[model samples]
Target chain A: MVGFEVDAVLGDPAIRIVVCCGSGGVGKTTTAAALALRAAEQHGRRTVVLTIDPARRLAQSLGLTELDNTPRQVKDAPLYAMQLDMKRTFDEVVLTHTAPERAKEIFANPFYQAMSSTFAGTQEYMAMEKLGQLRAADEWDLIVVDTPPSRSALDFLDAPARLGRFLDGKMLRLLSGTARAGGRSMFNLVTASFGAFSKAVQKILGAQLLTDLSGFVSALDSMFGGFRERAEHTYRVLQDPQTAFVLVAAPEPDAVREAAYFASRLEEGRMPLAGLVLNRVHTSAVPELDAESSAAAAARLGEEGDTARVLRVHELLMRQVVRETEVAAHFTDRFPLVPVARVPAQPTDVHDIAGLRAIGDAF
Target chain B: MSWPARLHVVTGKGGVGKTTVAAALALALAAGGNRVLLVEVEGRQGLAQLFDLEPLPYAERRLGDIDDDLRLLAVDPEEALLEYLDLFYKMGRAGRVLRKLGAIDFATTIAPGLRDILLTGKVKEATTRTDEAGRRLYHAVVLDAPPTGRIGRFLNVTAEAARLAKLGPIKSQSEGVAALLRSPMTSVHLVTLLEEMPVQETTDALAELTALHIPVGKIIVNAARPPLLSSRVTQAELKRGLAEAGLPTDRRTVTGLQSEAHAHLARQELEQQLRAELAHLKRPTVELPLLSDGVDLPGLQHLAALLRPR
Candidate 1:
């Protein structure tokens, strides 16, 4: 009734990259796995799904207790999955850019060290780097990704560019000022701060960080350029029509609004919009009683005092369903045309491949 | 414990100005003559930027003259990792090699919830200091915690990870950390904006905190939008205002007896969001004005002024 026709988007071959994105706890990761499963089993294409999420629940979804950075072959023909280890990958890239010595110096440098680990955009940039790696591998016919559920998902687009700017930014130059014009040593005053920090580091680690920093910087030198250039390539790859951005959300107002924001962002950035997936949809045809009836049932159970907890649970579930319904309606009104596929909530946690398969069959 | 040390932990959602708030609050408590140690996990160095100082490392540094007693430190994970390692085995040379290979990195970085435990460990150590300084070197330990989305998992990391590692330093540390988190002296503050998602997350966060036995001290509703209209009004007044403003009339527009009927509808929506949040019945709520820009030192000071016990 909301004009969401799912087949039209799914059957399109040009829809190469399906990005599953939404807020946390809204089943975004599970939905992504389902979509990949569907594409492989139903659509008959080899698919690889990459998740930028830090949550370790991916193993539970894939019927495994844990996963690593490498792609694990889950089922037959079309599905392969891997959780992106951004820091490890970034470290690898850093090692490729500069000489071992220079890389060590750079990574050990206090400023670069600070920016690499804790800066905001690094995750986004690293995600792009992962995308670039996957797109170039071309091992799969389709590539899917589950993005981090941050308010700034568009950072997926802006991250690489931001990183490039930062690497070339005045901040680096300011820090570099501490290095001689020949890039030999830091300025005198900064040396004192580093000295204080180093003393603290020595107090804590007994001069081990100095040695590790040296090794890390040396390895990072060769990897820096590759990381930057590949980030740029990923940015361009996302802009291509082959990369279809699927914005996933729940029926809730907040979830739909986040999806709407993502869609608007894709439009603003000229990124392709493939479709939308609305998971955990609830319908009135649940065969459940209305609120008044539920209240009566709860009161009756309480009066009998035999099954009071059961009746209370039923009432709570019913109320939650109604609220979920309201949230879903808000989403329907906002996103009009992007093909939306709805997956209803299940009675239990998705802990096995069978569960994932049932979710895939929702469409 | 005297006044400043009486309250121990400070926490809130990320990007809601937790680090800034912690910095300013530390400064305020220091101004009121208390030794405060502002700590951060996940190695963000946000405190350095907040105080307009050079970058802070794993060790604590005095944030001079924000107050004489106010101090800040960003506990580095690598440093924390070393101390943790040193407590158990001699890292001699091969241990250093293992650390370089990121063998120990898993303990801090990739380990499920271990980082959170270590992070909380730093705060707990700061809080429990009975050193002969008798000065109570840190009367308060303000922690810049992770964002709300993953905070439940962050704080509960110790208990959850401890379940996996039955008998190791990790387990012992986690158990010790969990005790401190569940203790009464620690108070959790949830910082959220007036927006739909943040408020919703705040509610979920409150439930999670309560379940974990973390006493939520207060809900700091950051960047709250001003009330555009009063609740007491009739349909006629709404219609007259809408007609005067030459706006379209619709059922959704509150009968359009006033100029801002449409805005009233929007306001009603916000109220609904707030109402849904209040349904949880946890902790008192405080509101702050929305700022034109992200919070800085001056802005944090202003916010701290509001947070001061009236």
Candidate 2:
């Protein structure tokens, strides 16, 4: 509908993955859908947009009442989409890498379960796992993912490596008796902390906590490399050009600052960034008959208090614009090469596919 | 009823409806005739939205029947820094320089885990604030804290920083803040959904908070759905309801059958979650009804009523 030409991020036909990442409430899901929609409609590729946001923001955008771990086709767009159930994805990863008995053993472990579901990088790691699965799919030509709002959006790429580092780190190895120093244990102090911690943990969790932790850690020790290689593979796929990363943000100060931080983080990591999609930006192109002018006109038309009302309205709208401008500047100032497209704030929530298409038009 | 616990720190992961709970609690407290201050840090400005007011700033704005008794303050980090410096170090010139340099914002944003210290510090100030006549103006202060994931690290950092900054004003203040935080008088309320991730995170958050000696008051499970499936036939009927609603189907995805299967399994999972959560948390567990529409003011007020003394 517009004169803009869409650029292929990965650039290689063989590369069919796109990762949409940024801070919270930045329309990451909308951007991912637009990209997936474009890939399907323009390139004639069957695509899927996956998200890890528990808010179901993308699911709402795509007009899905509720999305599970499984991808579903929506409105004949020749695409499939889903919000990755993090716990489900983690379970799938465990099942794929470990035996059923081993998986059960791992799941039964309290420490392992806690780390899998509630730790800082769990969502990021699960997202990477979901991406890997989608990339390996035979049916879809393109797979688009929307990552979480944490600073660790890309950290899942390093999760396996980080896990390996964790295992190799003094803490775990010290527990494993692998870091033998002078044939004496170096984990006495840590062990004591762990003992006090375990007792506290046991008292809190009803005395079976350490048993679960030991078993879980043991299972993790056995199947560590497979998980690492999977993570490393996802990282490589993400770094590839065919897998373009679009950073989404709103024109709000906090949202834009987060986007700026994310962009810089990506730049440091040398990730392939496609562009920035600044959603819900308040426009300055409204007629001169805005709150300020309208209020003045109202007062002049014999309503004394009307002018104050109009000025107050204008002040509010103006603040909105200023916030947007601040956020926009933050993005453009940092990433000069990356293009930014603005989607004006809608009066209502984008809960339908038509609304999603309207957002998609901005890209 | 036992002094209504001096301060209630309602915290959870972001977007778990902390501000909503805080608003409701204030209204409930006021209904029970206690002057309260609903405080929010991290500058989310969510309280104004909950109260259906225009976006609020650092100033305490009075609203509703709760007003005259209850006051709401969304603590601005910059204002908190000025107050802190003036009250503690008495550094008038240095404060201006720090404000000009955006050092206050920098401390809130860039540094590792300092935002928590600032946030906790602000909440502490609110809970401890007295009137000009040296009377305790607020019977209670409800803090809408950061989400559960960060709360543990947030509390731990101040205690950690106290050791690092030992002998300075920061050390003394950090230790003071830590004592209040760990005290039984302050209770942390975790808001969660009935879903897997939230339930699991609640458990983890509770464990972490307990380890830090922070007392948990209650668990407010938001957006909890009633059971849709009863008997096998009812489950089948539920599946039909979903299928008629325009869910897509393909050879691989038999939308009717597969979704029902997933939904059925999900129901069982939610049941397990309920059992686990109730077993774990000894405090009063309040189940908030899922709203058919989005949660706006009326919905939050209804929720607040549920938490009130009947």
Candidate 3:
């Protein structure tokens, strides 16, 4: 039931972290960018925005030709931006936790490469890892993060535990343990050693590939616990009062439903939710008139004239306005205390700093 | 020639109405009197909620009046794997043992490709299933697949399953699923909105599908609004129209009309620009109206009728 006071959150010295989360195509990234820009330009806080979107629209709008893992300061604003390179972040985590030789061996593993880049939930996990790193650096007064665009991103709360379980799974330990024992006794050791499960795995994966996989798993097993520990620390940080979660949604049924779904999730997780921001709301010019009256008036005005056409256009607008009101009311009724800030749909997509500035003004 | 494929994988950026579009397509295809099974793999229960029906179980259930031929199934990876094991290996009790031993979790997580294989294998099985007369059980199977972000890997089952399990029924099953997916009998439709981010993601999905060698189907644009006024509305014309309407001379009413006219003009421009950009993708396209009553059964039927042409 928190009132989403964007400027108030930005102005508070104690509130250092802002997380913008929503389903994809709901302008979550744009909201994060605008939040960062507003915090930096108006509130005079040094800010950085991290986004997981592969699209370089954020980079292009920030006037940068390209964005890599490293944060770069924007041209005129007091803001910095960076795109999370999942594979690079995963590699860095591995390299930091493992020996140089072992890390190199792990890096060359095909399975490792694939998991680091394209695994279902890896981007969200890496994004959380990056958030922890940025917070630890203590450079920016305000940090805004745009969560990855996936329903799975909501399961980020379980990432650390899941990764931990996968890393500590018996198969890895058994494979690595046997790989170090010796290749000659590998089959005998696997069969006499673990159980039918390991035997099935070995027979299925083939001897040569099993050897390569075991070598890879064995080399990287030491740092297994660190990944989970860091993720857990960040998960705790997300629950801190200093962190504000802003749920953004467009004025559509699906998007609104998703926003509510995410809000409830944040509540369950005990994350500090600032409030909901309803983006691209349609506010009609003729607010007092009902849709029925407007339609009737347009019909009575006749259909063949320019005036009639204009009235017909007005009727359409009125209907949209009425529809938007009903949609808005549903959210308000469901989440009574969740204060909403409505931003009108822009005539065009926000491309440059001016567009961001205009949005800042609108809100 | 109606829809062109027995299997249609409906995918797009998140929040772009993939569920609605897929449901509409399923209804449309079934309206042709073909038996259709619409399967969802993400475990979203999106179909149930979209239709306001009971939450679908992993097992296929017949949705009520849509058609006897049109059925919906929510496929969970875990259930799909167990079914796959039981079906392929006839390992009913052994499948329970694999679950207890965490073999299922290992395959699903450590070897993520198997998850996709399980999902696609179910779809392939449905499409390839035949009755005594050799007529396919489901003439059409519409898959509400994963989003564009993961679809490339999701459909590249052959390569991924090969990377992990080199031999056994798993490898052979994955190859079979891959063959169906890569064949002319499969088509993937990408749903998107006429906005910059969605259009960008649509293009990215198209490029990835091209690289994956999957044929692109129609581009379905959801929640599209009709243009009220052309972008070229002149200020003088607007003023004259307001005067000719003869409804109001009050300052407030006049101002309201003017603002409404301006907003409509702006929207028309934005719509044109975004749609023009999306058209650059060069795929056959379908546009569905943004319903005023919001998402409902009647609205879904409206969308279904709209998708009938495609």
Candidate 4:
């Protein structure tokens, strides 16, 4: 297997952004953090890692508790880490894009409050929004992004467009138009389907909810174009040669399948997929001792002896190694050209700088 | 043996085999002539893949060969919303018009918590659905719910929808769903691996679910691997054992095998520590062994047998 040159990506002066995306529980957050740390410590680059919903200990390790939405330097290193606060980022975008009164109105709207905080796609969209903001600031030599733990790996890529399309869709336009016209002009619209649409929406969501949503939409109407443009710009940044998308996955069926799906999706989108980081890969110390031979040796010795127990352990490890290899091979076989960096499974969870440094070393 | 709850909402961190666990649990529940419905809400069509069937539609279909009483449903928020409207307002043509105009998408996707409300609303319907004789149609309902990170908010439909709909059928429906979720008839079982991140998320989710007053059931430890060797075994013994067993006694091979054993023991210790921590949570814990060959129907049946109440 060809090794993914982690240092090449880290040391490359042209690559300004590295996006680590994968299925959840595959150590995407740790990968992003380690990459950022490596870029800072090894490559001597100013780097900031943006993590979305890191584990509590991982957050504490990165000093993310003290820095909520803004990047703060972790210890003395040039590495900086910040957990994404989606609502705050959304509010910041609104405040920066609109006037104070309009921002306040938008913030005060119930629907806006709900959408900003708990909307299904809000985190993904806001993560991208924050990424765009970070890149546009031009303060860091490299930026590493940890995509959100969405139900599907593709959600992080599809969310911004989905939200943008929803906001710019005709339904919202009609609703905002109705709100702007005080509900009278909807009847005067060109088509009866429009009336039926409004009635149906109103019937499902109720009259007050529609009013609140329209109020929120009208407040956000001026910024919808900006939202779409920013998403597209960030997307282009992702597609640029300067940015690299590293798909991370464990040597498991589900995670590898997700990585395959994401790799294809990135290819379809013309996004620069640098390589795949196969995390938590298991390997046997003795490649010569196959599982079958080890199991046979164990059976010959019986289970009570130390030699038998060692052989049993060797058998188990060999089986796991084979399983992991086969699972990882699924991805490598599908995408033969994609370089893979396998990070051996660590005995303990990574929650400190030394742990992250070890992971970077593994890469 | 009766289950603890009629509705079992299985949630875990992403990639933790919650869908597999839920399917197996449903199969277990459907044993002995009991009817069970396994629900998937994430639109992932995971149930279909698990059962080796085609992508399931909104309607229920029997999971053949596994258990005749076991059924599967992939709930779409759009379909759920339309059904809700038809049930409440009878807006048949208006629903079609809304679909044509993308209002359905707008309502389900754009409206905060509306999608979750609709999804759980469907689950609640299945849970409480009764027959002509006023008997429960399904003996058990297993929901392959959202991940633990959002399970609390996902199940808390009333509070989530309160911001969107202050006073309407949506509000009332969410209220009803919330009531059912908070009732003793429902249990939100958390699935986790014996790893740091999943266990941490499970702990956090347990705290959150407890605070939200949702009934939590067992803590399912999925993909648990047993300790292969005793901790007292020494590296010296392993080298001697390797030579005695006619394996290569070379430095590299011995060292490699020793290191692999070291990692394996270390991982077993870590798993033991995590298991102890989970035990401190005071919930009944069920540990499912790792399926080395990966999950298929027979594997799923094996898991179901393990999940079956003794």
**Cα interface RMSD of each candidate:** 18.7, 21.3, 3.4, 1.7
Candidate whose lDDT is highest: 4
- lDDT, model 4, position B57: 90
lDDT of 1 by residue, B1-310 (tens): 1222334444544335566666656665665676778787755456675677888877777766454566777876657666665665554454464454433442343233555666677677777777786665666777777777667777775655443354555667777778777777677777765544456567778889899887777676666654434344465544443344343335544332222333334554666567557646556767766543445667777776776643
Measured on C-alpha atoms, candidate 3 has an lDDT of 0.78
Report the TM-score for the A-chain of model 4.
0.95
Quick one: best DockQ, which candidate? 4
Report lDDT (CA) for all predictions. Answer: 0.60, 0.62, 0.78, 0.87
Instruction: Summing lDDT over every window of 10 consecutive residues in candidate 3 chain A, give the lowest-scoring window.
Output: A185-194
Expressed as tens digits, the lDDT of each residue in B157-229 for candidate 4 is: 8888887788877888899999999999999999999998889888999999999999999999999987876
Residue ranges of candidate 4 with Cα displaced over 4 Å: A178-190
- Candidate 1 regions exceeding 4 Å error are A1-10, A53-68, A75-78, A99-120, A149-158, A177-226, A251-254, A286-289, A293-318, B1-184, B187-310
TM-score of each: 0.52, 0.56, 0.92, 0.96
Please give the lDDT score for candidate 4: 0.87
Model 3 Cα displacement at B62 (Å)?
0.7
CAPRI category for model 1: incorrect
**Candidate 3's TM-score:** 0.92
* Candidate number that wins on TM-score, 1 or 3: 3
In terms of TM-score, the best-performing candidate is 4
Q: Write the per-residue lDDT of candidate 2 for residues B1-310, one digit (tens) a residue.
A: 2224778888765445566777777777766567788887755566775676777777766676333367778877677767766675565666665554434443332223334556678878778878899987677888877677567876675654532233445555677788898887688888876554456668888889888888888888775654533323233443333234332223232333333334444554656556576667776677776543445667766877777766
